[model samples]
Target chain A: MDITNLESMPGKKIVKHLGLVQGSSVRAKHAGRDLLSSIKNLFGGELTSYTELLQESREEAMDRMLQQAKSVEANAILNVRFSTSSITQGAAEIYVYGTAVQLEATE
Target chain B: MSGGSFQLIYVIGLLIVAYLIGSYREKRHYQSIIKREHALNSLPAVNLKTAPKGHFQHELVMGNVTISVDYFKRFLALLHAFFGGPITSYETLLDRSRREALLRMKEMAKEKHAALVLNVKYETVSIFKGSGKSIGSVEVLAYGTALIPSSQAVASNVATTTQ
Candidate 1:
């Protein structure tokens, strides 16, 4: 599919305006690493545990975004973005969004 | 020991514990900031080249990246405290999410064979907020045309390199 035909391709498909598709998920943990983080902070070093946590959360968000795109029958997505917020001291939300487009040939 | 002296000793012990915990928290927060900055710096620089008119190009795929909010909240809380207010956790969460989204968008550009991503945008919403607690999240979107130089352009580059 040519990039130009990504929009306005023939066939009475349910064309979504602005292709504003979104996906989100919430996660919570029992503050397991807070004490460890405190200790690491005092000693002056990297907190490897938190590094892993961020990575996992980001992946979950992306997966959700992709799933949303698939449901809409979009062959390609453009202008994808992400966001996060705290639900509580120990919980957080990750969200992903993008324009879902169906491609078509220009000829 | 006298009663007054006993009370003094108890207070001193409590202060010592508070000092230890406070110092530890401070140290951990700084360490995380340094790590995140390092990660951001390590990313490769991207360059874009325009494609020729009327020529279709192959699809490109970019790399992937992940980020967490728990780690990010610590940094936000510290920043919020600096401004003389109760530590706010939502700031950190939103910041981390935005960074992760941008990284992922960049990865997609690289994979899609695009030289650059442009016209990026961001949006956020509040999911939960209450007494002594508030939570919200943000989304960032990046979009751009993926392109490669025409055959003629490629040939010229090859000739220049060989010469």
Candidate 2:
């Protein structure tokens, strides 16, 4: 399925609007990575472990959103946006949302 | 030298070392960011929904990064608070994170062989949400649409030139 953050797909016709679809995921830092992160923190640099955690969580959320769009029989998602919030010291939450729509090739 | 002068020399040495390491790290990070940005300059990133007049086959692209402040930056920020002035020390932290995020997104677009990325957007969140006075980890997420020019658009010309 094609996804774009624009309100409409260029060179395509929006045949139907499928309303809003969203997915969210919350993940906590693994103990092993947390330990490594703490060590990295002492030296002062990028915490690869935490970066991995954030990446994983965000991807998971995006995947779930796509699944939702698929269930609605939408061919594409538009105007997508991502937001994140920290739930606690070790946990992070990511939310992704967009409008699902069906597009037809322009003649 | 007197004991007092010797102690002064030790303190000064510590400060000098801190300054050297701190500036060195900041410079290194900036240099890397600049290099990555230069590599991605050819791939246009914009907030427009429409493809650049003559483009086809658009896809979604995303990149994210979580960067943390080093000890020196945090220490300087704290010291700046005593005088109630702006905390320029922390400015680089956000700068690095945002640039890293964009570079990552651009890298993904390159892998997809995309010519440009449109409708780019950015979101930033502090990992230390509830904690006050401590911005431990900062994350920036960048997303956009990658467009590739249509081969079909040039197919007619190719056919004529060959004939």
Candidate 3:
């Protein structure tokens, strides 16, 4: 399925508005990575492990969102947005939402 | 009394070292960020949801950065919390991470030969949330759709023909 954060596909026409679809995933940091991150904090720099962990979580959320779009028979998803919130000290939830729609070729 | 003095000295030593290293590292990062931003000035990323009128291909592009708060800044933040003032120490951290994320996104667009990026948005997350004891870090993610103008293809064609 085609996915974009824009309101509408640039070259395509939206034929059907399928409403809002969302996906979310929550993940907790591993103890080992936390230890490493603390050490990295002392010097100050990018937290590679946390970056990777969050990236993975985001991908999973996107995947679930795409699945929802597919189930609804939508050809594209638009106006996509992502939000992150910490549910607890170590766990974070990544939520992605977008409007699912069917698009017709304008060309 | 001597043991208490020893603890105080140790804390002071850590603060001094953290301050020196953190400032040096932040300076270097800002230098690199400014240089790369100058280099990538040609590509403009905007918040417009619709692309400019053109026959172009679109692709999703994103860049994310996670930066950890150094001990020195965290200490400053603790003081700021106590005094209830604007925590200026963390401002640079957020600014650097946001710029870095946007630059990375633009770099990806440049790779795709996209003339413009649209509907750019940012999401910031405090990955390790809660209190001061935890090592705090912020993650910034910048995302947009890249529009590769069809004119570039014709331009490339003309170049090949001229050769």
Q: Which predicted model would earn the best lDDT?
A: 3
1 or 2, which is superior by lDDT?
Answer: 2
Put down candidate 3 lDDT per residue, A29-95, tens digits, no spaces: 8898888887888767788887787888989999999999999999899888999887776678999
DockQ of each candidate relative to the true complex: 0.16, 0.53, 0.62
lDDT of 1 by residue, B63-126 (tens): 2222223323444455675687766454444455455545554555444445433334444443
How do these models rank on TM-score, best leading?
3, 2, 1
Ranking of candidates on DockQ, top first:
3, 2, 1
Q: Could you give candidate 2's per-residue lDDT for residues B36-131 as a string of tens digits?
A: 888789888887776667757777888888776655566677678777877886788788888888899999888767788888999988874223
Q: Give stretches of model 1 more than 4 Å off.
A: A1-18, A41-46, A105-107, B1-163
lDDT of 3 by residue, B1-163 (tens): 9999999999888888888988998999999999999999999999987678768877788888988777878888888888897899889999999999999999988877889999899999787643555437788999999887777746654776999
Question: What is the RMSD of candidate 1?
Answer: 9.7
TM-score per prediction, in order, is 0.44, 0.84, 0.89
Docking class of 2: medium
lDDT of 1 at B86: 64
Residue pairs with backbone atoms closer than 3 Å in model 2 (clashes): none
- Looking at model 2, residue B78 earns an lDDT score of 68
For model 3 chain B, the run of ten residues with the poorest summed lDDT: B127-136
Error of 1 at B98 (Å): 11
Candidate 2 segments whose C-alpha is farther than 4 A from its true place: B1-22, B129-132, B152-163
